[model samples]
Target: MSGAVSWIYLDVGLDTCTQGHDCQHICINNGSSYICKCQGGYVLNADQKTCSRSDACTQGHECQHVCLKNGDSYYCMCHEGYVLNADQNTCSRSNTCAQGHDCQHICVKNGDSHLCTCHDGYVLNGDQKMCSRKNLNLTLTFEMHVVVLIHVLMVMIASICVNSDKSYICMCRVGYVLNPDKKTCSRKKPRSSDTCAQGHDCQHICVSTDDSFVCKCRMGYVLNADQKTCSRKNSDLYKRHDVFATVF
Candidate 1:
């Protein structure tokens, strides 16, 4: 009806309301344009609208030829001839050579390796790589003559000491008597008590050589060659006395 009618108007901007919404979380608004944020451990693409995963490690920086991978990083290592450093970006030399002339065994050194060997009559212990003398046997013996000589000397010394210590009592074997000097024993003394009567009785005498003895009568007493007893030699005076007594 052409007769004055009222028209109702709705404003889109005023009516549009975002409640409990977050930028770069749920969505990002830019002049009627929107974008979504990437998750953790990821980055947005160059378009800034789409999300793409980030590559922190690229090119050779990612890992070495010989390396292990972890959550977000890697480690570098080398072979026998090379050694890796703390940074994991470089390598260095290893000490495998012997020091000075102290090394006796043959030594071989690689970039990061070492070995040792011993010369003749020697041996080397592991890890230490040092040489040492080999074990050997020792022999010893004693000659029979030497042993006999030592025994004889000891016996002589013992006898001298015993003789010097005891003065009154002398060492004498059976069938023997101590000489006047008290240093030796003579076997000339007879078993009869009459021969040894006064300590110094001279009934018999002995001649000693080496380790043997011989008995003989005193000068005045003649030994009846039979060794029975001492008797006076045949005398002319004794015979005449016998004749005179008979005549009487």
Candidate 2:
């Protein structure tokens, strides 16, 4: 036999092929080469030497019902009590009640809503948005007028009573008596016969109802019943009346 190149035995009980021999459709190991199989969720490259991630979601290319696309994968989520607006990235809640009702109290706006409450000194009306005045029937203006009128009348009566008291005191002054008219006082004067210093005309005289007398007259009169004394009325003229003597 001609000289034959001996085949080398590789490690681990494997017969190694000689260089430049073709092995069809089977894996061959070189000094540092090894074969690997693609796992789940991964795909082998066309040469079958490497693996890459298999994006299953992107393959379908469609998301249903609250699912969103992120890169090559899909994520599922729902809006927070709201919905995406025409621009899918933005969200919006309803604001139909934002301005609230047209009433007395203030309207408070909350997220997506509003409510109504009464202001001070008022109560909520049937509509819940309006407020009506408290004590609606009470009339403060009229009550004030009535109180003022009463006070004025009381002041007027007090003034009249005060003036009447002063006038009554003045009427009781000395040498005066209450007139039967009750509005005046008059001096009590004696009759002509009882006048004092009855020579000249008496200027004034006061006689008590008890038959006593006080008199004022011009000079030259003697006290007598008539205001004119006997010496003044008739020089040496004497007249006599019942138990009384007078100069005539």
lDDT of each: 0.52, 0.49
The digit string of per-residue lDDT tens for model 2 on 1-248 reads 88988997556544333433343233455553444456666656677656666665555633333655564465544355455555444555645354345646777656655667777657788887888766523423453344336447644221111122112121334555656754344566755564333443434434433344554444444556764343344434434352254333
RMSD of each: 23.5, 25.9
Considering summed lDDT, which 10 consecutive residues are worst modelled in model 2? 159-168
lDDT of 2 at 170: 19
- Report, for all candidates in order, the number of backbone clashes: 0, 6
> 128, model 1: CA deviation in Å?
18
Tens-place lDDT per residue, model 1, 53-169, is 555454236333466544455566665555676777676664657332335678777445566778865668655578775542211113323333533765533112121221223
All candidates' TM-scores?
Answer: 0.27, 0.22
Name the runs in model 1 displaced over 4 angstroms: 1-26, 44-55, 59-69, 93-107, 111-116, 120-248
Query: What is the overall TM-score of model 1 with all chains considered together?
Result: 0.27
Candidate 2 C-alpha error for residue 17, in Å: 22
